[model samples]
Target: METLRHIVLFVHLIGFAVLFGAWAVQAFGGKREFTRLMSIGMSIAAVAGLVLAAPWGLPDGAEMNYAKIGTKLVILLVIGALLGIGTARQKRGEKIAPAVFWLVGILTATNAGIAAIW
Candidate 1:
């Protein structure tokens, strides 16, 4: 079980890389829309995060930081929604605001901050 937790955490990290890495590249390159790959990576990270928390849900000696996790979840959702909105705007031939890109980029980085500093 311990090994499984570590594996899932690693995957979560990988997902973060895929999602944020892609975002960073696109945002820096002046691309506004969310890539399909980024969405896929975000989905993977979100699911793996929940799975990694499964053991803590057990009625045993397991303990977890629900507050931190909840905060992280909200951040992740905001990033997803922002990306979705940006994608919609792109599809409509509208430009996504620069602030939206910055917000999503910073919020995505905030997950790492939450993990390290929370």
Candidate 2:
């Protein structure tokens, strides 16, 4: 249904927000809060993304635009991976370079904007 699709889309977007916000918070605050918030948010976001990717029977063709959506998904995955690395590093009491966080945040925002249009 159209409504279901929209709801799924909304949830997916929220996931991205969680991820982006987590990284931003980490960038500003110290590792303590960063680790806590980022972990929780990323978990929720990843689950929501999985839910949104379900194969619902609609037209069966490109629900949105595969190429654009694919690009956005790729970017998100890359950011997610980077965040995961950051988390791992944090666990070892090592701080990742701040620029990495900034870059991830910027890329996430850009992907979100692209997703909005495409």
Models 1 onward score TM values of 0.89, 0.73
7-75, model 1: which lDDT tens digit per residue?
888999999889988888887774656788788789889999889767543446767888998999999
Q: Which whole-number lDDT from 0 to 100 does residue 54 have in model 1? A: 71
The TM-score obtained by model 2 is 0.73
Question: Which candidate achieves the best lDDT against the true structure?
Answer: 1
Q: How close is candidate 1 to the true structure, as a TM-score?
A: 0.89
Q: Write the per-residue lDDT of candidate 2 for residues 2-98, one digit (tens) a residue.
A: 5786787677767677767777776677452245555566666656666566666356575645677568668767777877887688778887877
Off by over 4 Å in 1: 56-62
User: For model 1, how big is the CA root-mean-square deviation?
Assistant: 2.3
> Model 2, which residues run further than 4 Å from truth?
28-36, 39-63
